[model samples]
Target: MKAPSTHPIKPATSIPALLKTAFVNALIALVLFSLMIGIRTEAGSSGQLTYWTRFGDLASIVAAVFGGSIVIELLRQWIGPTGAEKLVPPAVQSGISFIGRYLAPALLIFTLLVPVMFYNQRYILDLAILVLTYVMLGWGLNVVVGLAGLLDLGYVAFYAVGAYSYGLLATNFGWSFWICLPLAGILAAFWGVLLGFPVLRLRGDYLAIVTLAFGEIIRLVIINWQDLTGGPNGVSGIPRPSFFGIPLDNSDDGLAARLGIEYSPTHRIVFLFYLILALALLTNWATIRLRRLPIGRAWEALREDEVACRALGINTTTTKLTAFATGAMFGGFAGAFFATRQGFISPESFTFQESALVLAIVVLGGMGSQLGVALAALAMIGGFELFRSLESYRMLVFGMAMVLIMIWRPRGLIGHRAPTVYLTKAQAISSDLVKEGHG
Candidate 1:
């Protein structure tokens, strides 16, 4: 005979209790949102400060927050952290895979045709170029942060290295962009190795601090090395890229002239778009190929458990250096492209903010996810562009969105992680199965 369990089951949250909690949460949100959005300040006609209050804004925020709180409460009761398995079902995984196959080609084709589709709209084309640039940067950082599980807060140092390398080489030697691109990557990779050697024993916050200091050191050096780096004035008159050695200017030797067509500014813009697109594609392709190699597997193993990886006889030194070098190489390429595109180089462009944004893209996209990186870059950058009109509330909205995303998808937007090496048939793994950056 079996004995019945003596423990009592917990009772469900009462409706009144749920309502009370929601109301309290909404009240707190109302107070915070009111302070953020209810008041406005501007210069008056008499050159004095003026203040305005919007009751309507407060009411809207209260209602929205109240509604949001109620929904969150219900969701918490239904499927909290303990119910993670419900978040990623086998059916959902299959659907995602099905959509991915078609979505990738469709996206590539759309991106390829964007300049042509909006040929007359230079603004849109310019935005596309900016998006692709970030995508390349995100992919590059993913190698170190996502694959290698190295927290690099000074990635922009490598970016600056590449940009300055190209600028100095081109301005001093009159070298073309094509010649300086690879050289820039090499210089940046060398710096990456140099940085990697010293931080070989460090991890976590220590490693992050060292990388951050490295970035600041590079910036300060650039500022103080006025004779060589031009200090704050920066280097200008850097050459623009050419089409197979054909210049893009209005001269007779320009591509527009050589093609027997009247030179339109659109020609240069189109060429720049394709050039960045090609670079971004190359970055993505290389990352995908690398993930299947032995080194790549070693990176995943190291990311999951460094001690265990060393126990298995993996050389952590070479692995770490390779990750840094690979990431720096791509960053350098992007930096050189940026310099040539802008026809200028400056330390202001590579800042901690730039590193943060790249890191955000890697984290928000889901660490080690190539497709997620591209999608996240488009979302974050496009969101910024879209909300530019809401100048005052843009950051508040962006911050709120990020918080909500973290709450909803803590791991990342595309939270599922595909297996590095499957013995039998491969399948997407739930992010809940392991911490990020692990296999």
Candidate 2:
């Protein structure tokens, strides 16, 4: 390790020293509260939200900055350096450990308990289902953003295509849900390819702008194609999911009777919970498997350095197409599931905000890290939900929070430790034998 003296603490310096400085500064900021209150007292107007008024905002900003600074200093002291230089636990192997250690048992136990839990407590069950659905979406997006390093801003379009496709197919052609489901995926995949062709040469900001435009175009089409999509009125009374051949309606021989449970509307919620939970797990497993494959390696290589990937003879075109297709497929699946859950489909549901939310999950979680994506999704999505009860100021607080988080974590929540596949330990050790002998 380089001596702390090598870069001695001065105007800018060591982490431990930084932490001590931050702690001192925070105390100073905290002591300024008396002056903040004085300013607020003078700035308070005849009719305005004290919180929204300039004085209140200054106080809040000062508090948030100083508070954030103290926390940042603590973290910096604990985990020093920056960029790729900062050490982190490996994403993939650590994800395996996390799932095998905590998530698997938690899922199994929750699955066993939710039936009883829902019977007694329904709202929590509903929230659980929503979280699971988003988790599925996040995992699917992970395949595109995390592993492939593609930035898609219009992902919600695939979702819309899936939902609307299912809605129209089932309503118009009397197709089965299963049939419509796969058909929806195929339609979305087709659109994904359609999108892939135009933006084949684009990356970074150009790619993002193109995708954002694509998403808006899809939403506009849905809005303009009023007759088919039901316009802003939305398609209601969409069919719910079913077993192999039986529906979950209030019929004589539906799921309620089979499970020996009384029929309440909540049974639909329970069914959805299990369905989404299963889908999320499936998405996770498939992504893990794909990352170990040759094509997956090509995607990661392309992500890190497209020119170098080309040098290695990997076809960038095929890699990009596959990434788009895989991500769109999952988004479509989510759309179908959402339609089934709410029994509704509307253009409003597939807005840019939804795309922004999913993209935010990918970034906040750390690019190319599956577990990080899931964790980030849960934190950000659930945090948004929690803030819902904050009334008119909710969005204000939420936006500010995002700004602060990005400032504090410029790279991401987990930074540069993206997951990847490597040789087995025995192979690694054997390869290192000569180097070890030289050392």
Q: Which parts of model 1 have CA positions greater than 4 angstroms off?
A: 1-87, 420-424, 437-439
320 Cα displacement, candidate 1 (Å): 0.7
Per-residue lDDT of model 1, residues 50-130, tens digit only? 989987988888888878888887786655334334445557667889997788799999999999899999889999999
Name the regions of candidate 2 deviating beyond 4 angstroms: 1-7, 11-115, 258-260, 400-409, 415-420, 426-439
**Candidate number of the best lDDT:** 1
lDDT of 2 by residue, 12-121 (tens): 45667666676667567656754664354333577644542255655665667667886776665455544422333357546745654586467557665776766757
What local lDDT does model 2 show for residue 329? 84
Q: Point to the candidate with the largest TM-score.
A: 1
Give the alpha-carbon lDDT of every model: 0.87, 0.74
lDDT of 2 at 319: 87
* Candidate 2, pairs of clashing residues: 146-368
